[model samples]
Each structure stands twice: as structure tokens, then as C-alpha cells.
Target: DQQVKQNSPSLSVQEGRISILNCDYTNSMFDYFLWYKKYPAEGPTFLISISSIKDKNEDGRFTVFLNKSAKHLSLHIVPSQPGDSAVYFCAARGYTGKLIFGQGTTLQVKP
Candidate 1:
């Protein structure tokens, strides 16, 4: 079974708006959650993360929320820009440092 999943295949947003991306997971063992941004022909780069003990984390325009009881998580990007267009991936890391990723969501920021 896929431990993590992104239900939306893609999202489109106008520049300077807020873009929301969501994710769900089946495994409670995952203690660390992270979001990554990927461009074509390149590897995914870390965007933001939250620990299991924390409910929310933020960094500049990126924020991540974790709901352990609901087994769900989401990423928010404020003032979305054309440069933000990319595949967003949600990932969870367990005790072993092994990461499980959700199916990516492609974000198209139209300027």
C-alpha cells in the first residue's frame, strides 16, 4: 500500500495568490514530515518540514501543517509566483531515515 498520497494531480493559481496542497498518509510510524519541490530533469529539493510533535511549521512563504489524529497534512504557499511552478511532493520519514513520498502535485502559477 502507498503510505502517502496526494489526491490532486495538479493545481493552478494566479500570481500573488495563495496555493494550497494537501496530502494524506496511512502510517502512524512516520515521525517527520517534509515537503519538496521538483522541477523537470532535476531532483526534488526540500521545501519545509514538521516534526510529529509539532502541529505546524513555517518558513517565509511556505508553511506546513500536520494533523496526527487525522493522518493528514498540507502545505501552503503565500503570494504564489510563476517561479513557484513545479511538482510538490509530500514525504514522511520514519525512525530509520527512510522516506515515503506521496504522488506529486503539479502547481502551475500563472503570471
Candidate 2:
């Protein structure tokens, strides 16, 4: 039962504002966490990731935090821009290289 859940199906934010996306998992064996941004009809691209041993990871305007104890994680984008509007997927490696992904969160950044 590998289930990654993104409670919000969508989110909207104005440009230059902060955007936050949340994800939760029920599986305790997942050790790697990854966030991917996807555009229509295209494959998802890796944005940020954090290992189970770490608490936080950041790159540029994107940051991801993981809480192993709570089985929860979140992604934050500071000063989000219009280009940041996309479907964000939180995934975790399961039994193999296959990843378990949430339904996805559509972030609409208003111009």
C-alpha cells in the first residue's frame, strides 16, 4: 500500500507571493522523497528532493522539507512567478525504481 496524498487538487497564487504545497504518505519504508514539476503532455522534471536522513533541502526559489516522524512533506516557492504555474507531483521510491506519486497539485500563478 504505497500511497502519496496531496489533499489539495489545486492552488492559486499571485505572482511574487509565496506558494506552498503539501503532501503526506502512509508508508514508513519510503526513504527518498522527490518533487517533480510537470507541464501539459510533458514528462515531469525533478525539482527538489530530500533523503529520509535529512530534514530539509533547498535550491534557488524552491525548498522541500521532510518530516519522517509525521510522514509528511511540503514544498515552498518564494516570490513565485507566473512561470512557476504547473502541476507539482510528490513522489517516493517504492519497492523498485518505480515511484509512487500523488494525484498532483496544480499551482496557478497569476500574472
Candidate 3:
């Protein structure tokens, strides 16, 4: 069963604007949240992460928020740039320490 899901398959945002990516999960056992950014053929790289104990975490232009009660999480990018365009994957780790990922959302940052 798919535990994580990204309802929107894609998102478009203007350069220099804020871009928000949303993800939903059904598993309450998940203990960690992470977002990965992938460019074309390249493998997805760690972008940002938030622990289940925290409601928010920020790293530079990126921020991740976890809402345990709602079983949802989001990634925010401020002042998005063209180079930031890529496929974003939302992942969660459960008791097994194995990651479950959602259907990626492709982000298009237009300059």
C-alpha cells in the first residue's frame, strides 16, 4: 500500500516567488520527514528535513513543516530561482528506518 501521496503532479512558480510543495501521508508511525530535489537524470539529493517531534525546520531558502495531527508535511522555498526547478520527492521514515516516498511533484520555476 502506498503510504505517502503527492496530490499535485506539478507546480509552476515565478522566479523570486515562494513555492510550496505539499505532501500527505497515511502512516502515523512515520518518525522522520525529508524532501529531495532531483534534476533531470540526476539522482535526488537531500534538500531539507524535519523530525516528527518538530513542527518546523528551516535551512537557508528551504523550510519543512510537519503536522503530525494532520499527517501532512510541506516544503517551502523562498525566492525560488530557475535553477531550483526540479522534481521534488516527499519521503517519510517509519520504525524500520526505511523510507517511503510519494509520487514526485515536478517544480517549474520560470524566470
Candidate 4:
């Protein structure tokens, strides 16, 4: 039920600034961490991910960090743009690729 949690419900940031989103999980069995971005009328899309063996992973302007010991993870977006405004969801995948999702955090980037 509460295996995954997003402490923040929403966040606002100026365009071209950085946006940080946080997530925590209670299940240590999760080995794969992923961040998904969703627009209001569309399904969520995969953004970034990090494996449990690695503490951090980066792709272009996005980065995902995982702390296995603390059961915490975070997504970072650098130079955030208006197009980046959306709901972000943190998800965990086990070895089988089954995902458990946290309550989404809505991000708003002002132009």
C-alpha cells in the first residue's frame, strides 16, 4: 500500500532552472528505479532510471539517483523548460520488471 511515497505533491520552478523531485520506498526488494513523466491527457512516459547497483545515472539533462540503504531516490532536471511541466511518478521494478508506483508529484515550470 505505502511501499512507495512521494513526499511532495507539487513543485514550481522558473524556466531554465533546476527541478528536483524526491521519492522513497519501503520495499528493499526493488532493484530497478525509474522516473516517469506524464502530461494530463497522456499516459506516463519513461524519463530516467538507475539500477540498485549504481548510485547515480544520467541522461542528457536528466539524472536519477538511488540510495539503497536509505530506500530513497531522486530525479533531477537541469535547466527546466516549460515543456517539462508535467506530473512525475517514481516507480520501482523488481527483477521481473513489475513496477510499483508512488503518488505522482506535479511539476510546473514557468516561462
- Deviation in Å, model 2, residue 13 alpha carbon: 0.6
TM-score, each model? 0.98, 0.94, 0.97, 0.96
Q: How do the residues 1-111 of candidate 1 rate in per-residue lDDT, one tens digit apiece? A: 999999999999999999999999999999999999999999999999999999999999999999999999999999899999999999999998899999999999999
Each model's total of backbone clashes: 0, 0, 0, 0
lDDT tens string, model 4, 2-43?
Answer: 889999999999999999999999988888999999998899
Q: What global local distance difference test value does model 4 have?
A: 0.94
lDDT of 2 at 42: 96
The per-model lDDT (C-alpha) reads 0.97, 0.93, 0.95, 0.94
Considering summed lDDT, which 10 consecutive residues are worst modelled in model 1? 94-103
Show the colliding residue pairs in model 3: none
Q: Which ten residues in a row have the lowest lDDT in candidate 4?
A: 91-100
Candidate 3 weakest ten by summed lDDT: 39-48
lDDT of 3 at 9: 100
Better of 1 and 4 by TM-score: 1
User: Model 3: per-residue lDDT, tens digit, 10-91?
Assistant: 9999999999999999999888999999988789899999888999999999999988999999999998999999999999
Candidate 2, residues 11-100, lDDT tens digits: the string is: 999999999999999987787999999999999999999998899999999999999889999999998999999999999876566689
Prediction RMSDs, each to the true structure = 0.6, 1.3, 0.7, 0.9
